[model samples]
Target: MALAQYARLGVISRSAPGLVLARPLLAAVPRSTTTSVLRSLASSARAGRFASSRREPGMVPVGRRTRELPVNTIIKFVPQQEAWVVERMGKFDRILEPGLAFLVPVLDQVKYVQSLKEVAIEIPTQSAITQDNVTLELDGVLYYRVVDPYKASYGVENAEFSVAQLAQTTMRAEIGQMTLDRTLAERNQLNINIVESINTAAHDWGIRCLRYEIRDIHPPENVVQAMHSQVSAERSKRAQILESEGARQAAINVAEGHKQATILASEAVKTERINEALGAAEAILAHARATAQGIEKVAASISDSPNGHDAVSLTVAEKYVDAFGNLAKQGTTVIVPTDVNNVGSMVAQALAVYKNIGQARETPTALPKDSRKQAILDTLVPQQDTPPARK
Candidate 1:
């Protein structure tokens, strides 16, 4: 198996005498992989050079080395999500992708392997003065990714520490620009502004600012009290406004109801008045019709009666007796007939006038009864003055 393996990997000699090399190894691997391999081997060869680099990563063993160094170097294996920065004589050379790479020994160096994954870093709590001159203690977290390995390794001493400090200073500056209320109220805007500010400066450092989040913001006791009071007052004002609106709506409803009731009541009154007027008008029309009918009946009877004269004379005498009787009963001073004998003459004149009216219409009726005439005569007769027999 050893012979077959040796045959498969044919070995050759370099330009130097007695120096055997496996140039086939570098030929079989890619330039990047071969370069990385050579750089790591060179880093390990420089006795004290790689000693301090022990803290750095990417020291994995790939192949066995002979007692004599080879002209071509073995390739290094790079894992996923990792990068290796190569420096030629301590100067920036190239970034090694995840693969097998070889380099010139003693000339190239594998500085370190950098992680391209995102990391979350916590920013310590810091005291800052707002634009309103209010002092507040605040803390947050930051997420970042390393985009460029070369700049990350050589641009800054400590990327994590430098990023943290930059975030702190930028946060303070941003907080200083705004008032305390804006900072506390607009957290999203604050985070966006902080991310923007940090990203602007972090591009040179090969660090990408992903996102930032505010964790805690502690205000002074006095400020907290004032905020609480302001909130309470706002709540109270809203409640009062809502209550007033409710009351106003109720009042409008009540007033509308009253107006409707008044309209209905007035309508009823108007209807009643119209009904009463209609009833009165009907009564007056009936009364006028009744009066006309009564007058017509009396006139017809007078024209049909042949003895209408005697009946009229009897009616006049009876009416005169009734009047004299009522006057004698009610008044202390009585109105005597001008002459007691004149009553008979007045009734006789009434009889003659009615007789002439009946003859003209050609109607004859029976005379009144003899008793009624005798009673009328007796009522009209006055007793002669009686002499007083004794004082």
Candidate 2:
């Protein structure tokens, strides 16, 4: 009776070959058309043979053509950092976010799955020629994330594989702009450049190219040997330059030291000569002053004497006799006057001459006024008459 009513309402049709039942018809098809209706119809057609497929034992079949199930069945549960793409009637409809999700079985099937977590893709190693025409083998790894699930599922066939290929192409292009030395020395810059390039081109692919790292770069063995030789030569060049600089500095320092020592020695000599001359001058001046003091005292004493002229005459005669005796004692040769008494007369004449000399240009020192000094001079003058005591 239900099948007749459904048939009368134009909900079902029959196929020609085996009277197969067709799907129920609706006045207006829904945007989210459920595809489970077809599965149910098919399941009912094969009911007896596969009734136990998804059925629990000990449960009897509720109807002859189909088994009844709850109409508003709630399907729940989603995973963390996972996105599920839903399709209605075999057409992509919507994407399911993380956490619990509802689906009308078969109709809202998960068509595409995308992980929201970061993915690391290894770019295959390949040879690239640098700007300086140096060929090198390079490999790298790329990190990316699926920012948009809808585009990730529909924009590209394989996200990891496509990103890897894009990263490789970008890396090669970036490497081609730099020399081999720059590539090796500035690896971090190279990585950033490649990542930027990949991200710029892969923006539409729902991928956020986080970072790209060049794992390794290998040059030829012959190039390695050449680099080693170049390094050694550079080191030797720097060492020679340093050594020459040190030698030059040492020579300059030695010359400066010699100049300083010579200047000091000359200064020392000049100081010594000047000090000696000062000493000699000081001695001469001191002697002159002492002599002048003595002359002043002697003149004053002479002026005070009553017999100053006679005293001076006697002193000169006595000095003459003493000198004659000293010459006879100093050497083996001796001279004797023809008349020894004549020596007294000669001394008297010499004294007269000395007294005239004293009056002419200079005054002689006066004898002391003491009686003891006068007595000695008187005795000395008398004793000089006997000039005779042999040596």
Candidate 3:
């Protein structure tokens, strides 16, 4: 029975050969009391074995480990980008850097571990009110790093949480200072302001705020709709203005073109009229020149030929008869001279007029004006015979 009890308490295994128990002590205890004690011890041993088995590998129970490091380890290897704050006898001592480090067992303990590398913290979506009284939901990301391990470990209970809260408050404050339009438009500047504000407060916590970026901003649905409408209306207004300007320019151009065309047409007409007048003048001058040349030739012929005068007299007689015939044919009534049949007399009158004109031409200043006129008239008029008593 004692041997079984010992095996049940795990002091010895039943399968082990040659296992022994103290008979005197087992005998001295009362049988009932001995069974109860063995049962309690067996239960405790089972519990301890089960708990030890359940614990994670390489992990010490809480309060038994120094800052997650294995207890009683003299040599520790610190990872890169990490800082381990050490405490010696419950007081601040020194920090352990990356790589291999030694610690006096039982005397030195790692109190806190800080990450030297940058960390990203999410700023949860929170309501913010703009200067224009518009409410917005804003969320962002914050990038930071631990600069001083000692301060990060001692200055603040939780560096990341504190920085995150500061960032949110600062973002809200900045948004409150700006109008809705500015908040939406100048997101980058808003982020920068938030980073600056966070760094200022987080300096004691040994955290440097590198940058802040707004992930999203959501305005009310009505505001979004209104903004859309405003943009559409503005675009329409610009389109109308551009169209009107284009139309006005087109009209101006058309008017200018018409004016130019009219001017050009008028100029062309003026040129045509001038050309026609010049042609007519030239024609009239040419005719006058031809007439003067013919007259000179005729004068030369009359002076050079001895029969010229007779030929002229005969030509004048033929023309005078032809003139009378033409006048009779032109109309039923004709004005005839009393001596119309006397062709010889008309020829004599014409020759006399021709002679006077020849003499005037020979000496243009020889005859006075009155004498030349009277001479031509006397030659043209025939002498009248005495008329019978007025019929």
Candidate 4:
């Protein structure tokens, strides 16, 4: 009986152990390939975790290795300058092709924008006195360009602002030392000199001085007014001088005309006087010739009167009578040539000559009664003897 109970208890124990063993075998039989696949999956998951832990943020993962990637690895390079920012999210989306990319960290980021293309500066207008003690104003412009990008970026805190300030200070110092007159007189040359001076120093600051211009200058109002007045006065003086000179020339012309007229009048008078004198002389010569001719003819005809007393008396009486007759015809006043005392003597002489001629012509008369005595006396007398009878 003891042995049977023991066998029975042993069988129960065996049955429980067999149940445990059968349940495990049944589960193992259904999941054999699945278990192998699960094992491979777990191993793959472990490897992926390991890869993820080893990768850098901006690195491109390439199977167990990481590469410092270019900006174009996942996005197009939108060209960023140093110290500038760029948003490339959409660009990266277009470039990435189910792949990986790397990029420089933010601390090493490059800039992407440029600076201003041009810069201008104005120098302060300066007041100065010229060598002539004249006050003047000087104003100028400064032009500059960035030569070194790196120096422009790092040399000055603000390149434009710093260069402008430097230029102002430098120009002020230079202009103040110059006289106002010099600044005004040599504006262009001063600009070039200033530009050269500024450029010489600006080269170290990565600035290049380009062309410079002088804008405007203002002088004292009085100086300008004085210059204008001086010009006007000069013009007025010149006009006055010209007018005076013209008047003088006119006076000279008048004098010359008067002189010519006087000379012509004097010459005319001289010619007239000479002609009158010549005419008088010719008349005197012709009258003398006629008188001589009359004298010669009278002398030739008086042959019987050689002593010439009767001829002279006759000629004188004839001339006197002709003069009286001519004076009566022309009604001219006359001064007779014969004296009253000589007139009777001249007439008696003429009568005596006539009687002598008559007596000579008479013949001895025949007796005439007159008685016969009177006839004889009458015959003895000349035929021209009328005066003896009257006595």
Candidate 5:
């Protein structure tokens, strides 16, 4: 039994040269305990030798190999706004939501870990040509979130990178369709268009494009200078138009003022002429009335008084003399009456003329109209002598 135990323990085996020296130590030990211990060690050595003989190239020994457990391999605690995609036996299986989740050790693997939180991605600056042949450098930021973990994991590889590239392409296409002026003026609209386009193409990617914002736009230096010059020219044109309008309005006002002044002046002159004519007419009427009144008074006195005719004749004689005196003082040219010294004869002639006029007025209807005018003329002016008639 002792020999058999020693043989089983490898102490007596010539194949184990190193164990040959432990035979005495094995003899001192209890047979049963030593046999059990030695049997286990011998079996372990046989296993090691067999494994080494069949080991693949570069394979580490079992004792020296490291055993590390991957995260979420068995039990996992998911955080808020996070999702884990699990594949069973390398196939689609289920998703792990937030909170505690247990997974089959080797059968289930968390293939993709996606965060449900919003993410901001920056787009690198790139050159794009507008419809107006203007080249511009544009950069922007994109906001996105994963809505479905299954699609986010399997629908598209590298979701963030793909979405960012899609954003850049969409922006370029949108900018290309518009002119430089429109692109600059419609930045918000441009961003909306880009987001819409990206969302359309990435629908199956399980990513929601929340918004896109243009951070900066850089145009060529010459284009910027040209825009500045255009703005200046437009402002100057507007100013010129306003100035011309003002000048034209001022000229019109001045012409209107002059026209009004001229019309007022004409109206004043007309009014003045009308007033003067009215005054002249009134003066003539007043003089005629005073003369007629004086003549009527003189006729009434001549008819009422007994010595009226004689007094009138005497006054006429004196007036005739005063008229001659005034004519002599005025100038040297004077025609002396034939009977200038015969005052009594002149008075008699004046009285005779007054009596004739009184008779004509008393019986105006008795004489024909022609005879009456002839009689008055015959009395006032002397008749020429008749000449002999020639055969």
Candidate 6:
């Protein structure tokens, strides 16, 4: 019933045989008035098996007939070429050249002609095996251009889909031949190899695979985690080594500083000792020089005196008394000359000794005051007496 309505409305072309019902009454129709009559016949044919294929612009379909029909005659049937152009009018009509065209009407229709420019294909997610037999998920994008319109439209059912399959196959093959390390290190080479291989296989389909890119690589979760841990461990090891080296250097510096300080301290001690020894030697020399000067002064005074005999007696007696006093103070026992045994004798002996010493200097002794020695010495000194007897 729908087909009958489409036929009445002239929606489908009736050019192909067995597509619509044939009417003998419309055979004798003239071309100028035949459309209205065909429309009436289509209204009657709607309830029958005469279905309309499609309606075309500037062209009409003729009903299926047992007899051969001439071209260019008006009928309910559409020509194969006109129907072909009409079916695809919505897709390529703007680019298609306007002229006579043909199709099989319901049996054949025109498909859209895609542009020949570069088209991007979003690669589907895929898995590939590495040389180590590790599976990886990868994704990418593809760039392609159509080289031939006819071949691209007819040669393959889907040129983009065919290129994608080729890309996936080539990528898998390349990846399987290489280890994971090589695959990651030589990604540019991998991309070029896949592109070339895909381009070679896609020539028949009128597609030129210009470039293939492997964008992101997804390794196994365990492998990624292992790599992360390895990196962390390496960093930690380096840090510890550096810290140890720094500590070792610090210790070395401290030891060296202590050694230097000890050497300096020892040098200071040696310098102080030398200075002290020099000072002590100087002090001893100064004391010896002062003592010698004192001795020279005393000797000169004694020599210049006129009564040198008396001066010698007094100085000798004072020295003797001082020695005795020192000895008595330092010792438990003291010895002195016995006055009862030798006082007169010792005094006379001292006077005689003094006389002799004075004669050597041609001087005389001064008698002690309030002593008998003054009168005695005055009486005995200048008398020219008889010759001294030898005794």
Error of 4 at 83 (Å): 11
Global lDDT of model 5:
0.73
**Model 6 ranges with Cα > 4 A deviation:** 1-112, 182-189, 213-216, 248-391
What's the residue-level lDDT of 37 in candidate 2?
Answer: 36
* Model 1 C-alpha lDDT per residue in residues 1-391, reported as the tens digit of each score: 2222422455222222122233434456576754655454444344322222121122321112112222224355666877777776668788778877787654565665677788788999999999999999999999998998878888887788899999999999999999988998898999999999999998998999899998999999999999999999999999999999999999999999999999999999999999999999999999999999998987788789998766766778887667557646854223244665666775654454344434533532333345434433444455579898996
**Which candidate, 1 or 3, has the higher lDDT?**
3
- Between the candidate structures 1 and 4, which one is better when assessed by TM-score? 1
For candidate 6, write residues 30-52 as lDDT tens digits: 55445654454445444454423
In candidate 5, how many Å is residue 307 off? Answer: 7.7
Cα RMSD, model 1 = 14.9
What value does the lDDT take at residue 78 in candidate 3? 85
For lDDT, candidate 2 versus 6, the one ahead is 2
TM-scores for all candidates?
A: 0.60, 0.57, 0.59, 0.34, 0.59, 0.40
Residue pair clashes in candidate 3 = none
In TM-score terms, candidate 2 sits at 0.57
What local lDDT does model 2 show for residue 153?
77
lDDT-sorted candidate list, best first: 5, 3, 1, 2, 6, 4
Tens-place lDDT per residue, model 4, 263-362, is: 9999999999999999988988888898899878777767656767676776778865775577468653333324455765545543543353345336
Worst 10 residues of 5 by lDDT: 60-69
Please rank every candidate by TM-score, starting with the best: 1, 3, 5, 2, 6, 4
Alpha-carbon RMSD of each model: 14.9, 16.2, 13.6, 29.7, 15.6, 17.7
Better of 2 and 3 by TM-score: 3
Q: Deviation in angstroms for 352 in model 2?
A: 27
